[model samples]
Target: MNSCATSFVFLRRSGYAGLLWVLLLSASANTLASPVSGTLSAVGSNTMAGLILRWGEALSQRHPDINLQFQASGSANAPSALITGTTRLGPMSRQMTDTERRAFTQRYGYPPLELKVARDALVVIVHRHNPLAELTRQQVDALFSTTRECGANAAINRWQELPATQDWPFGAIALHGRNSASGTYGLFQQRALCGGEFRPTLSQHPGASAVVAAVGESPGSIGYAGYHHLTPNVKAVSLINAEGQAIALSENSVQSGDYPLSRYLYLYVNAPPEQPLPTAEKALLDLIFSPEGQQIARSAGFVPLSETVRQQQAHW
Candidate 1:
């Protein structure tokens, strides 16, 4: 059998069995052919672009002929690309909406396959010098939204509006956030802003790193970005939980959904019904579902999926 067939057969049986073993064994034993060399391209979430590049680097070490090329436009670009058949892999930070799924189904006569690859959290950050610590949901809504749909009776504009910073010397809170094209923008709008519109004063950025940099530079500024983009120049603010306790971002908290902003990162594939996935895509996914891949996720500052979760999706 060809390398693709061998990988597909093994993956279908083993669920998320690590790809490292298969490649090493095939190379050392010379029983199976090596993975064919070619370029694999993907486009989507800037939040996940770095992680994917890291994975691609690892993949190239094993199959030197295989190269990876991708675009980190925004999560909104992923589904459209998949629909148009421009690319087979679509990495997204948010789940596909009903409309997006419908559009794919209409085009292909089936739904696109969504694979959960990792977990991440959208965190609120302030300049490290800022003494303010925790924020209530109402306060969060008031600070970033024009509609205050999260139930804040009043909008929070200046630093004094928050009781924790009422005596602080800071003036108006400069707001920063992701642009509408980003999945981070949509998720933050849905969860933090309660589906309300952002205030006109909010500075929109193209990527999470940009948002983090802006927050770090401006002493009175506040913004939200993926946890991986965190830096010492900024401090992640804890959110008040339902019990009125402060819940900080941690592996345990985000994994258990204790952190209100926690979310799953996804990779959408244009796998036609009953057809085997393309070799390049399957090999990359095999590595992603492996222990080494999870380690790469941790090193990159994103939470890896647990063993139990991997078992549940073995058929994928």
Candidate 2:
């Protein structure tokens, strides 16, 4: 059998614990030569801002000649940038929507190439001192959304409303969230809010760090942000699954999809049909899928793609 076949067999037997070695073999087998000099610019996804910045730093170290540029307005900006050909690489926290795909197809006669590079989960967090344990989907919706589109019968306004915090002295729950421009906001609205609108009182921040920071500072606070944004001042609230089991954030839970808010992080490339990817862009991808790149991802608190998924993206 070929090396790819061998890697798949190994993956089945060893799981993600052997992910690094499997990716190393695949990357070595298909490594792209370094480009002497060029600029690689990417736009979109503030949620991925830190991870991509780390990747760019690593890329710069390897190829001193390459200039790296990134803009992290939000995921919404990525599709437009790719469609306008303003950027060759677009890092997005979520997949492009159907309308965005159509627009790209109209502009380039082909859909943008989506490469799933990592996985993450959205975590609901509270100040460390809060004793509240887990929340059901309906409770999360009611707490954050005035519209309560997720079938929450009424608004959850105070700490005492939930059984876990009935004895707390807090009168009202302080809420924090991301602004409309963030993909994090969009995903939370869709999944947690059930396509509903947030309460008018929800404090919206420009980035994940800000949301996390706001939650950490407020004693009666509750908010949601990417799992990586967790800090010592705050703790994540376990989310109860449909089966009535509380699902805490963990490497295994996120990877296995037991985490309710699990999501894929992507790099949407503007490579057209019947052509090779640009040298700098291809080199960036090669490094991203390499062991070193995966290590950067893991260090940034994002989950690396499994070898099977890596194979599909590597060939893309």
Candidate 3:
């Protein structure tokens, strides 16, 4: 062959090989970038279930291949589900107890990743028609403390029985509280009831909405629930602090630590995610910490976290 002809043939072969390599790399990248399909299961925290469900609905629009399922029960059940391998994530309204955290670590060989999803204010609620708008810390304690039989005693039921109230509206103080499994119930018992048992007469409801509904439907009824659960039929009562100042619960007040009843909300994930989280599950959790997600939290009546907290939650 002529020298020029041989050189042209070699150059053409090299150009063709380079084009083939480019095509192969592009195909591999496309496969890696494609969406993954799988089911992600989470359980616990009925208080947060509604918000999470809404997020899931929105997430499905963007990630049709991923399947997400959630079960709302008591916060205590979540960690159990994780340890048993029944769920990848657990939603909890309160921080995990030391015992529970230890159990998860022992079973999984690593501690579960903890994420703070939002802030919640535990508010005292009364019937909208009730004239009493606030209660002193002492008065709140007195009402819930079994030491006084406030629940069963008619004498102490009236608003007038409360300190600093002589001419306030008078009526029986019907009490509504959550079931033992509820996180709000635990918090109320520790903070307001002073670890005292609730009165036998105190009505036990299953969830926050039920508690709020019970209080709202009954005249002179009082109860407590997360601020997000409060409705127009029920009014949130200001709590008198140790300083004797009445403080109303609000996102600003709760985030600032001025609201005495405010508490943290958490998401507990098995460390390293036993199985990879479906794209939809990861995206939904990401949205919960995103600016848009925080707005949804706020709209749901919970306190959104600060930017610092949001960033920390995003990593988990």
Candidate 4:
């Protein structure tokens, strides 16, 4: 072949290869870019507020295209916001009720997807100065329930009524707890009170922080809140289980089901199986399950799922 002809062939082949490489690089860049661009709104579950806020902040750093907004309403508000198409995500401290599911299905032609993201134990907290360190589930019931037990245990109105309450000069035992709007209150009622009603005298706070604060400030008082809310001003009191074991609240005990009040924390998504979840919503989910997300949960004083459960949940 002529030298000019050979040079032309080499240039043509090199040009085609370079074009192919450029096309591949472009595709890779597109893949790395944000898939969705829009605001993502989540509402409900004050128990999940701190963790979600942290996740949202991290998400902003990773995907500046997404604008994430959240509201820390009580868990009871999740189903309604989800039904009204007002929120892309809803965090709940409890599983959705059948009524809630039906309402959602009626509105959207499918039930909301429920994801278990974390676990919490409903702990009874008291002022650190209060010497009461433990109580049986039955005792908790008597203290909180209007239908008091046998005569001797009919009421736990006084701090002194509790056995061996040390050196506490007490008046009435002030009671505090989550308000009716809170999922924590519902769970506490079911798990601790055995579905009994809260005594009318029980002071109801709007959120866990308020309950913790109230209990922390009251000398002869106690309140129930998520285990994660434990702070220096207040102390978690151990609960006695059926076998007379004083189960301490911890990630290990809660995950092992040894803690009587341990329960799952959930995120209810408004996605249908036939349709893909919104990209921004899915990204937030990734952040929640990411290693950094789990660390954020730890910082919020909640328990991340155990390794086995976490792996299984990731596949979901």
Candidate 5:
């Protein structure tokens, strides 16, 4: 993730002159994380890496004396790092669990502060060539888990097994998903699996790209990842919630609560009683909520935090 800034260089339009244009160039992680002098560490959430690096670069220009660093391990690492005093800033794609919050309160005498950073749709993807139209919450439960709690689930394993109208001969469905460390993995279990455990056969990967890539390359494979990780070779399948309305995964759908798997990305910090957030942290969070920071987030494929959420972040 760190080297992504220099990995692929691309053209950004500098000026438009009808027929001829002055092209500007940019990096995937460019202008987002400028180098600075001090030491700082941000550990957690591979999903938030690109967006944070972009903000870090921009923050550096405004405060050269403060150096803010970040790590993109996985969502599960965030609360743990904060509890251990290993990182001041922990980014997460899901809400901290009760177990995680208990540990933080025991360690810090207060629950770690969480600020909603962005909105994301947790999407299930399969090879673009797959003819499947949509998946019901129950069907997804049956496909991914052993427990068939959702009314429609029947421990289905093949394309023809679904109650969908069209059935062509296809191999057994292949399941891929994030490993235990991913918040997405947990959220899916709760929502899609209806509190059921993931089947032992599910192939668990470390990050979103890996999950999406594996599914894209395998014709029969299906997997889930943040909306940002969807690739051209893979198509996001619409998911029907328990309410019976099928909704596509999109920023608007996620924002409007129509997307069943929509989730809030977060940042956890310790703002000791009225003492201002440490200077470096303050600068970073300000950039995060600023129009510029939110724009970068949008460009990275996340929905901006709602005005109500931003207003709450302001008060927090």
Candidate 6:
């Protein structure tokens, strides 16, 4: 009878140990299923402020535990912030220069992970009341260049001097542009002005919105900005090439490489997260390459990437 009791006691203890092991394993699995927690900070690209703000709001709704903060300063400050470890993500409207890329890699010991988020067309806007419907590349260049006849300070300041003048407005053309530090300014200098310097009379506005507002209020004024900011009071002029073909800016044209003024919008990140990114941050970026995110990008007046680009970004 004593030996039987010993055997029963052993069996009971063995069963208890097995149940404890099972309980521990279940707890571990539950912990793994929980979402990661942390904060994500991003800066730069005032041009992308509206879209990202909307994205952040949506992301926060799905992830109540994670914090996402953003700032809409000039794009030139983004790379600097990244190199100095002040921000984890940097949004830019223009591509990085070779010198800037080399400096960043030297400081961080790795190249940045660049993700193309959207595409924007550089839109030339004029007052809504203006009758000019299109502008040739040369004519646009002449308006911003300084020379004997077309300089900013020249006395022949009327729009009638341009090529198409049947119903031209008889007034001086006032120009408004972003400050030198703006990514839009850099893009305009390279693509529209053909690397030529801006004229003296070109007024420097604080931001793209200001440029749009200034142009909208002035009858003979002109300005350029991302197509997303075009207002009803401002008319977007069609760009004509040297061959006299008018090209409208649209997602179809931009994706087909037919829009000469379209440029990629980028989100620059560290090679690996220096500080742990919340699950929501990772998921938000993942969704950006998803079909749903692409749809949002299109609706916001930006071009979505092709399937090929989306596949390449999946690995990043």
Q: For this target, which candidate reaches the highest lDDT against the unseen true structure? A: 1
Per residue, candidate 1 scores C-alpha lDDT tens digits across 271-316 of: 9988887777777888888888888998989998877776554459
- RMSD (CA, Å), candidate 2 to true, equals 10.9
lDDT of each: 0.87, 0.87, 0.77, 0.82, 0.79, 0.76
Error of 6 at 108 (Å): 2.5
lDDT of 2 at 264: 90
Q: For residues 1-316, what per-residue lDDT tens digits would candidate 4 score against the true structure?
A: 2764565567568877566556555655664676655798999887788888888888887776678888988788989999998886999888889999999999988778888888888898889988887888778888888864422257687877777584589878889998785677788888788788888988988667888998888788888988877789998889888899999877899987799889888999998877877778888888888778877888888888877877777666
For all candidates, what are the clash counts?
0, 0, 0, 0, 6, 0
Model 2, residue 207: displacement in angstroms?
3.0
Name the regions of candidate 5 deviating beyond 4 angstroms: 1-38, 163-165
Score residue 241 of candidate 3 by CA lDDT: 78
What C-alpha lDDT, on a 0 to 100 scale, does residue 197 get in candidate 5? 86
Tens-digit lDDT string for candidate 2 (1-316): 4886777777767766367666766555444444356999999988788899999999877776667799988888999998888998899999888999999999888888889988899999999889988999999999999898878798999998899898888889999998876778889999999999988888999778898899998889999999898899899999999999999988878877799999999999988889987777877898899878988998998988777777777788
Q: Cα lDDT of model 1 overall?
A: 0.87
Looking at model 4, how many pairs of residues clash?
A: 0
RMSD to truth, every model:
8.5, 10.9, 9.8, 8.3, 8.9, 10.1
Residue 17 in candidate 6, Cα distance off native in Å = 41
Clashing pairs in 6: none
Candidate 3 global CA lDDT score = 0.77
Q: At residue 71, give the lDDT of candidate 6.
A: 89
Q: Candidate 6: misplaced stretches above 4 Å?
A: 1-34, 147-156, 242-244, 273-281
Instruction: Write out the backbone clash pairs for model 5.
Output: 32-54, 32-57, 33-56, 33-57, 34-57, 42-71
Give the candidate order by descending lDDT.
Answer: 1, 2, 4, 5, 3, 6
